[model samples]
Target: MSRFFQRLTFVLAATIFAALGLGFALGEFGMFGVHAGGEQDGAYRQMHVYAEVLKRIQSDYVTDPNINTVTTGALHGLLESLDADSSYLTPTEYKIYKNRPTTGVAQIGLIVSKRYGYATIVSVIPGSPADREHLADGDVIESIGDTSTRELSLAVIRLMLEGKTGSTLSLSVVRPRKPDPDKITLTRTVVSPPALSEQQYENSSILYLKPGELTAARVDELAAKIKAAGKTRKILLDLRDVSEGDADQGIRVANFFINQGTLAVLEGQKFPRQTFSADPSKFLTSAPVAVLVNRGTYGAAELAADAVEDAKRGDVVGERTFGEGSVQKTIEMPDGSALLLTVAKYEGPDGKKIQDEAVAPTVIVSQNTDDDIDADNPQPKQGDEILNKALALLKAKNS
Candidate 1:
């Protein structure tokens, strides 16, 4: 963008932001006892600056500028400045985004992040093509479809992996052990994440329960697992890799353990204080439980961990969880563009926002990246560092 346009866009954004009505910001976050006139004075001063910039651009610019482009780009950048999750979709992107079906899309089912100048697979969804391909944690995906994943944003890399069902993606991945990257092709399909899995060490009272991505139905499945684990001396609830589930379902999962008290709290600028409390009738477990978390543990799973740790009902044993709980409001612009803005955030029992601060584990046992973690048949046994630590804690408490 030209300097003239850039200046115009910046001024335009400042004006639009003022016009958006920040009544709550002033009332909730600003200095108390400050008169409304004081706030108006500040806004007027900024508006005056905006006008000056616009006037200079209109009179002295070398070429005739497109007002529409300038305004749109300004608004786009303004939304983006709000947060990483906030995005401005262009009209073309909006069309595809809105038309996209909620039915599961074809995806490699990897939670990835930028690491070592490439998209690294943090975890793979069990039963998905990525899991079946034996993609392990800490595996850095060097390239996708001939383009280096390093050249793309994590979001773009994820989009490239997801499409209509039956689509295929070729990946060049470098496992921590491999000296050379391995070339692999995975065919995507609807991945219904396994809700819950249960296992007991042979001739041991230690029952391990792993709740996969906390989908709506998974809550019931988890309750059943807890019920069937009946009278187990020690319980290990593996929340590692369990993220991206419904907020309400997460509260439900917490409710299963917490008889009463705040399960989760939601607050925002426009949104009211909505506190979800536990339902005593839904309480499912009083047995000592241990929660295993990692950077991959997100969304609903994070909430579940928050409850378990806060209520003193269980010990969280693993690495810090990925803070992913938030309420996003997607506003469709008049031009068919949209802004996905975070309007509210999930708060833990102690009132810390989940999306801002990760839930720290009581016992921080981080996994060795190269350690073997069996995804297909997850039975946390000896040498499974995080789970073993969790088991030891639960057992010590049980005895």
Candidate 2:
């Protein structure tokens, strides 16, 4: 009887030990129900499952599937499930995205956005394929080749639009003014957007500086030119349709006016709030300034507008800006893919949160007509209405 009890105890101990060993091995090798403990375990588990599913499909699927297509589809699904903003960028796509803000690539010279399930033409670059094709502002992109852009994500649409410099792609767009609401096809071409354009208004003291995608260095050069042009007392910094880029460059541009004070603040999770200040030495002009912003102004452009507004140095004009106040940090994956994660939120100098509610212009101006919508080919005489209004305010203040 004693021998039988001892045998039973030994067998039970062996069974318990074997189970523990199996659990550890499964957890370590990333198999079975056990999990390798960590904050990113969830993400890892998903990735592992994705890989296994891919393997299963490739090995035993009834029909032959293209690996590239399968991977892209899986990645797209994964990103879509995460959030609208989060996305998986392939190696080639990631490279292009990284260079988009810094480098001007082969583009059709058009500013576009997806609105109400359609790609809306916001601004047309003068002399570009879209402009040359007679594609006017407010045109809706219906389809790209056979693929409808209605259900496509913004990133995918942008990728499809961009290709090799000389390559061409068919774009089916809908013009509001056309008699029929049918799609109009256009070919793609290489186009560069102009940085700066200036003109003297008929009845205002304001010199309008329309800089589109102009680098901060280019803005500084233009500032010198503006100063050298004449003794202009007040200036209009038109940031309509301007997207965000290098914040440091924005700070430099803002420093030209702000003598001293905080420019903007960055608040991040697990990180301290960091304040960016303007140096007094970089003041370009002490003249009263007015900044013009529309719903299109965002990112670094919004930051610059906020800095100018916060310092009480300029009166913001036009409509409210597009509030994209989140900071994205790019993380590269092992396969050369990239993930752009929103790491922080930005605040204006006056402690205004700029995430959802954008900075509103003091003087509200609306773009109602086709002429008002066209930023490239403004009406020969009446394009600078917003600037003129701002200049009038400045003149009144001086008077």
TM-score of each: 0.77, 0.70
TM-score, structure 1 vs. true: 0.77
Q: Lowest-scoring 10 consecutive residues by lDDT in candidate 1?
A: 24-33
Q: After aligning candidate 1 to the native by TM-score, how far in Å is the CA of 199 from where it should be?
A: 0.4
What RMSD value applies to candidate 2?
Answer: 9.9
Q: What total of clashing residue pairs does each candidate reach?
A: 0, 1
Q: Give the C-alpha miss distance for residue 64 in model 2, angstroms.
A: 13
Tens-digit lDDT track for model 2 on 316-386? 98888766676655567645766555567788887786765678887787754345524554323365577
lDDT of 1 by residue, 1-399 (tens): 356544454445434543354443333321222344565557545645655655666668897666666565555555545554555666776776777666667777887755545677767887789987889766888999898864554445666778878878899989865799999999888877765677875355777778777877777787887787775456777888886678888888888778989888999977899988889899877878888898888888899999888898889988887676787777765557666677889998899998789799988987764554565566664667998777667767652
RMSD of 1: 6.2
Full-model lDDT for every candidate: 0.73, 0.65
Which residue pairs collide, candidate 1? Answer: none
